[model samples]
Target: MAETITIEPITRIEGHGKITIILDDDGQVSDARFHVTQFRGFEKLCEGRPYYEMPAITERICGICPVSHALASGKACDAILGVHPPEAASLLRRLLNCGEFIQSHALSFFYLSSPDLFLGMDADPAKRNITGIIEAYPEMARDGIRLRKIGQQIIEMISGKRIHASWVVPGGVNAPLDAGHRQTMLQMIPEALEIIIRTLALFKKTLDQHREEIRTFANFPTYFMGMVDEEGNLEHVSGRLRIIDAKGHIVADAIDPADYREYIAEAVEPWSYLKFPYYKPLGFPAGIYRVGPAARLNVCNGCGTALADQEWAEFREIERGPLMSSFFNHYARLIEILFCIETMQGLLAEPAILAARVRAVAQPNFPEGVGCVEAPRGTLIHHYRVDEDGLMTWANLIVATGHNTMAMSRGVLQVAKRFITGAKITEGALNRVEALIRAFDPCLSCSTHALGQAPFTIRFMKTDGTILGET
Candidate 1:
């Protein structure tokens, strides 16, 4: 007889996801399927819109990372217009991207995944949440919330609105950077840095405290991909593509970011609608790769900034460098927080950040283009085709969450085997399984707003299709 276990409507993560475990006749782990449930038609609905409308239109896909979509879409517009924005425009774009990184990572690390880490994975499920987190570690919770507020402040300060679709227009950002606005952001950076330092210290202590748990918690290796600076330093907003194997070896190093079409091949598994993307060097299933902060750390040689560089060295010294487990991904995110704030500090030092040439005037003429940026969640790619009149003909988006679909499914099985037992399910076991998935901090809207469970009935059957055993 075959046995099956299902983990449904996974908690603490954005959108939805489910895990189905199928056991063979011998009852050994045989198969696991991660299902994404809802269907979103954003890609389908955007057809025939003017290219300029894409920045605002695509921003609606996910409230979590709208600037990501806008930048991606706007890069396509820059190509269509045959002009890159002025230096100040580019700097302003980087400014907004750092804001996205800060806020989104804060939500993932502190709001969603922190409950399990800080509260203990085995703690009562109903109580193991942000609320519970506040009750238990009020100061830590406050720091996290404050960090997210700073990110929101940066976004609002620059884009003129806090969340979901601020103005990052075609040639550049809609508004110039004001001295007062710069000073406001400058004032906030020191506080944000302090938050990151405190959080990094806490995460380091937690790593030592939960040594055994961290090792066993969804530990597996796969290909890693992300953008990195020329010297192979981690690059969140812009850089070249770096792909590395599980052993911390750069299998494909320094590939042009825009030329990712040459190395990426998308595969559709019969079990779900989300497509699995793999390294072209290796075949599907075999080439299953991961992308995100964890993947970014794994692929990059260093973080380039000071404190983050120190953490990077310390991170590598951890028996294993570049952390393969989902547990350390949380810490890697904190390291990124350190890097983003440091990088912002550097960018602000440049007087060009306050320049008035924020938007450039250009004639729309080109036919197509591709834009690449690393969203807080992972690497995001947006490619658009347009007509001579700047009307979008077609669009393709590779969101950060989509890059982790394979790993998410792989992680589902790993966690199910460890937590989902055959005995009457306890909330502890179910919460553990969900906690395992939330480590990915997936945004289904970026991939597709989808994930849920369907009751499955399996029975023994003969060759002629006659049922031999039924429940």
Candidate 2:
């Protein structure tokens, strides 16, 4: 008789997380937990640093979404400096943001989540990884890898290195965009566009095959949130916030990012270190909403890129304008990739992109500042209070992954009940649990929570019918 089930260090994901299902005396799933086993003390380490260094320092939060951190921190630094970045700098910042969205989203769908989608969820546990994906579809594998490389290449070409910290700083970019680099990047745009379009097309075909699965897979409704442009176009940076209900009614619109704290509040969950962020109007558990690709796609009007705009419309048609399924989050990631390539192409045509004046000189002037930008994973916010001489006094970061904590727990419980039963635990049952977590494409490594293996076994006290311990 099987007593416990554990999924340790789930594969093809960035960080460490585990889920255990304990069976009871009657062989029922007695308890379920999705625990994040890591810690990152960025708040403590950030103290005492000058505000000007925040952009680079905070960018280290997540290698996957560093651009989001850089942008948020840079914006906070801009607020601290009390100067608006030049139009050219704003354009470059948006361009870099597109690169981040493309790479991070690609990593989420193509690398982490696709394994279960492409190979059946019940596919051999050992072969159900990227390696399994490579053997099954070599070109698709190459596409995801090469496509991610293009995004990193853009970041490197612009910032002087991959994951280059400090390229963004108070008031403006530390390194200006060079004419030659833009030209080089411009040359690659056509190829990049083709790659994105083709990959998206292929993904659509896969989605078509899995339409039933996509619809019913994880169809639970969620309150959607994201920063949208003033005109309601999907905003990755510098826009008013919008929150919409599952049925597509605009619950809140044109909300400024600065007033974010007022509209959103964090809630603690006993099972996970990650905090759940929800809309204030609805209150705690009931207000539990979702952020990231699923939330962004649901609330945004369009991607603002020509080709991606067309694909975005088609995506909307599939869901009759807004998709809420956590599964389609994969589709949303691809759509954004299409948008990023298109956005990058549009930026290249602008003379300012190739212009010399990317940075404006300025000095920090504020005692407190807040920075926010949509990371590929979700909306990332960084707030800091600085002393007159610019010594950091406090740090508060609301990571994209943290925003999904509520939804993730819900997803875990939902999946556990669906696949886990009185029968003995199997690798497939365990994969379903991990697969549910991957659906969020969570970035726990980048979030406040750290990443480490804590292999655990959950056993039941069958005779007394008491839940025992984490062994």
- Model 2 residue 119 lDDT? 89
Clashing pairs in 2: 38-450, 39-450, 316-321
State the weakest 10-residue window (summed lDDT) of model 1.
450-459
lDDT of 2 by residue, 1-471 (tens): 545666777666667777766677667776666666777788878899988777888777777888888899988888877888887888889888887877787778778877888887778978888888899989878888888888888898888777855688787776678888888888878877787788777777777666544654456776788888877887788887788987888999988677788889876545433355778877765676788776887898877767777887888888764576677887788887877787788887788765567776776677878888888878888888988888899988888877777666656655676667775666776776777677778887776433222222222222222434323
Each prediction's RMSD over C-alphas, in Å, is 5.1, 4.8
Candidate 1 residue lDDT tens string, 74-116: 7767877778898988888888888888998999999998887
Candidate 1, overall lDDT? 0.77
lDDT (CA) for every model shown? 0.77, 0.75
Stretches of model 1 off by over 4 angstroms after superposition: 1-4, 23-30, 269-273, 449-471
